[model samples]
Target chain A: MGGPDYAELCQLYARYAAALDAARWDEWPEFFVEDCLYKLIPRENHERGFPLATLMFESKGMLQDRVYGIRETLFHDPYYQRHVIGAPLIHAATAERITCEANYAVLRTKLSELPTVFSLGRYIDEVVVTDGGLKFASKLVVYDNELIANSIIYPI
Target chain B: MDGAEAVFPDEMTWPAGDVGRVPFLAYTNPEFHKAELERFFYRDHWCYVGLEAEIPEPGDFIRTAVGERSVIVVRDDEGAINVVENVCAHRGVQFCRERHGNRLDQGFTCPYHQWKYTLQGDLRGVPFLRGLKRDGQVQGGMPPDFKTSDHGLNKLKVATRGGVIFASFDPDVESLEDFLGPEMLGYFDRLFDGRMLKILGYNRQRIPGNWKLMQENIKDPYHPGLLHTWFVTFGLWRADNKSELKMDAHHRHAAMISTRGQAAAAAPAEVTQVSSFKASMQLNDARFLDIVPEPWWKGPTAVMMTLFPSVILQQQVNSVSTRHIQPRGHGAFDFVWTHFGFEDDDEAMTQRRLRQANLFGPAGFVSADDGEVIELSQMGFEQKPFHRTVAELGGRDAADSDHMITETLIRGMYGYWRKVMGL
Candidate 1:
């Protein structure tokens, strides 16, 4: 029994960023376990131990619903988002689970404007071993920027 | 020609006296924006500072804004909340950089010069007031008649009700009760019914549009059924829902109250005709819509109250929040959402509230559309300031109505805007 290696973790992150960057939102939830927690919150609230989050999906079902919202429900000016994720720093590792954190910056380019840094944050993750190699049991995105530019159409 | 006077030429006329048609200049002209700041935010109006829950303990302080001016809301040692301008009296430095913190021991000290003020913003200590002695002779000291009391931080007149706090820079401003009026006060009280509020979290975004547009967004109920697909398709908020539009006597404030339509009710032509509505649309996770009616809601499931140029009190089903509109110049404003729930709410209810909050804020399912549209609207306004917009949905007049089809609320706001702005 062994945990996911550094190379495997990087591959997982690269694939995740690729899917989000290409707007293949339908495949987003597949990177997570069935009962997963995905939350995007500000550092202000996180440091203060607040319960609010910009987007909180408790289960994979909720993430799928969000995908549905991005695809069918929400109407906005379509834009492209590129994720620049740093190397993951492993905090702890076990045969069944691993904990890691990484810095990330999301750049958004509207059809009419130049690319701008839309969201600057770090991902605090808890990955678990499953048949699919590695999946996120909990993914918490804590953004450092206090004010957002209009709205965040795509997930960070 | 002077810079200030040149900006105010005589050619900026509103499109109509009835306020049914508004010119783009209202959102484009910088001079008009400055006038708006003076008339609406700076004087004779109680602008929201922050919740009392935010500064519960003595020495707790949070830096907030009244319009574009920075102010600090703090709880003093004697259990009194005070709002003081962040600008220091000496040298006019805008100190107090941290957004929120507990400054119990040292009070507020300006880093530029060690000028200390009490928790109540009273000027208490000034170093070397008699000048430092280098050769046994006093030098570079203030005049003997200089008084510390006169140099205190600019304290605002604060009003607290039901744990919410509002402050006014104008000393002659009317009481908060009178400012809200009787009708608007009822809706305000209904949401803030004297219960201790537990802060859930916050979501802040800078919308690249006029601040008034954010007020108009909540007031204009015509958009929810048309613009927000999640609301129309899920029967959460529709034009056909039993709704009422109300306004203060001055028409500066409004409350858009709507009861959720019956889920089993057949789709009427009003809803079916909407392109955003899809009969097949359903949530993969039903918990997002797991709305449990509370006793405080009374009847209406949603009540969006725009409290004039400062804040919007929102109660959309299970989610509750305060949306503060802090204007920045004419083209942009910072919209901050403070999501909260009552202190006595059970764990299940709290979770429900947080889940339903997904439909709001910067990344909200329904509200994200609003932010985008507002930005686009501003771009259009800047492109052609001579153009005008038509708000003549129900009629050319502004009045309260029983249905959500009317744009009366927006018309009502512009009516008041014209009177106060003298445009």
Candidate 2:
């Protein structure tokens, strides 16, 4: 429904990442379609065929659950994050779907620790465009950092 | 148990070639372990630090602890990986405090007092005057105690092969290839294939066991059938006939790999287990399955090898990565696992890989069994209360192994261990 091309579909991505980086969670889920798949995982376990990930969600509700978990439930350092998204390149495209690949890095400044890189990865995204602009059918974050110093939380 | 040198039967004495069961002290004692860290591990031995793929750009950095010493391995301005001690030259405050980054213009700066250094660990500048800057004579200036040149980060010997960075506390350590050797390195290169990597994901776990326990677990294939009922009961792995073979190296490093096949039928009655969970029947559709649709009975399906002391090489189908471990205490360890794929992996392929990626970490059905079992072993071994545990399982001689159940590889490790620990 929007520009009906690659850059438009990708602009929606950079916007979504920027908003989430800004803690605009209310606007975060709007970028995803009804059945969205998202997983934030480290590289070590994945090589050994291990599926335990930092964040694993199969739908928009799961993404919302993660947001809720951070806000209401689990304990983490009260911090702020800003995601810097690189230019996205289209990997593939179909009549209804567009696949975009972009490099992403997040800087999270916590209470005591110095502002450090929270997460860095390649965003392998599949989006479907409808009347509601572009929606994420799935987003897989493949983290570049092998040694995760402490626990990793929040979306990147 | 306290400072009492381990006493045992002549057979119990280790690094000596023998099939007799060795004492458990070799596995449990802090003195013995300290020796291993200092001699074999820290001295003239290669340790996997981080992946070479991590520092992709000039000035990219990752801070990690090799042994207890914090190390900052950063890609310098020229895009070459430089492994330096994380401890700064001036104060003890660590530079590159965060996990990973790119210090483009300004080099690494200390968090505490603002002492700055380049990626190569040179003392670039100081905050104020020589001392605290009184009447042109500052108090507490650069210490006469140690000069900046005299206090460059304690540099360790580092080398790389297969896109994995390895470092040793000892500069005299053998080159990476010589340390790994042709037989072992050849098998390792299969996973490395030398293509640009696309990271899949990562996971971490803390197991209640010595770091060596993890090394032994990956090298000992017997545990797969005996321990991983989650995979077996779910029809994940049927024992293949003599498919699992053990290859031992001089440094106590070993590779345990299983060729694809069904176990020699009628080998053991307990090998097969009945399933209790209904969902077990559903194929998880994880990435390992994505590579080969049918059961693997001909080619090698899984390869698990250790890079000595602290890291593991895991190859499951087309997904490859490393599992690095840091021993927290005599009975504690922090485990890290990384996932990677060729850059050419398609979006659909990447998704299938993520879904099928389940086996060896904390949540892995196959590897989750390990944490429970590792603790049980630790508890059982500790029951001897500073006494030694027995490691000879399949044979009596060190390095003598057959049919996957042998702890001889462990004894071979102890041999190298004693040589390093100078026991």
- Top model number, DockQ: 1
Kindly give the stretch of ten consecutive residues in candidate 1 chain B with the minimal lDDT sum.
B1-10
Alpha carbon lDDT at A72, candidate 1: 79
Report how far off residue B422 is in candidate 2 (Å).
3.5
Q: What is the C-alpha DockQ of each candidate?
A: 0.84, 0.07
How high is the lDDT of residue A74 in model 1?
83
Interface RMSD (C-alpha) of each candidate? 0.9, 9.2
TM-score of chain B of each: 0.96, 0.85
| Per-residue C-alpha lDDT of model 2 across residues A9-81, encoded as one tens digit per residue | 6578678877977888767767888678776666544444545465556767656644543444223336688
For each candidate, what TM-score against the reference? 0.97, 0.68
In the range B1-423, model 2's lDDT, one tens digit per residue, is: 343653432233444453234456655677666766666556777767788777788888777767656788888887777788887766676656677778757788888877777777677777652677678765886555645566566676778776778888877776788888777887777777676666555576666677778877776665676566544543445554344455545746677665545422332344453233222233322233445422221367666777677788886554456888877766767787777766677776665555455444554445655765676677667655444556657665565343665666666776666565555
> In model 2, which runs have C-alpha deviations exceeding 4 angstroms?
A1-156, B1-22, B128-147, B241-244, B262-288, B293-298, B386-388, B398-402
Model 1: number of backbone collisions: 0
Q: In lDDT terms, which candidate is top?
A: 1
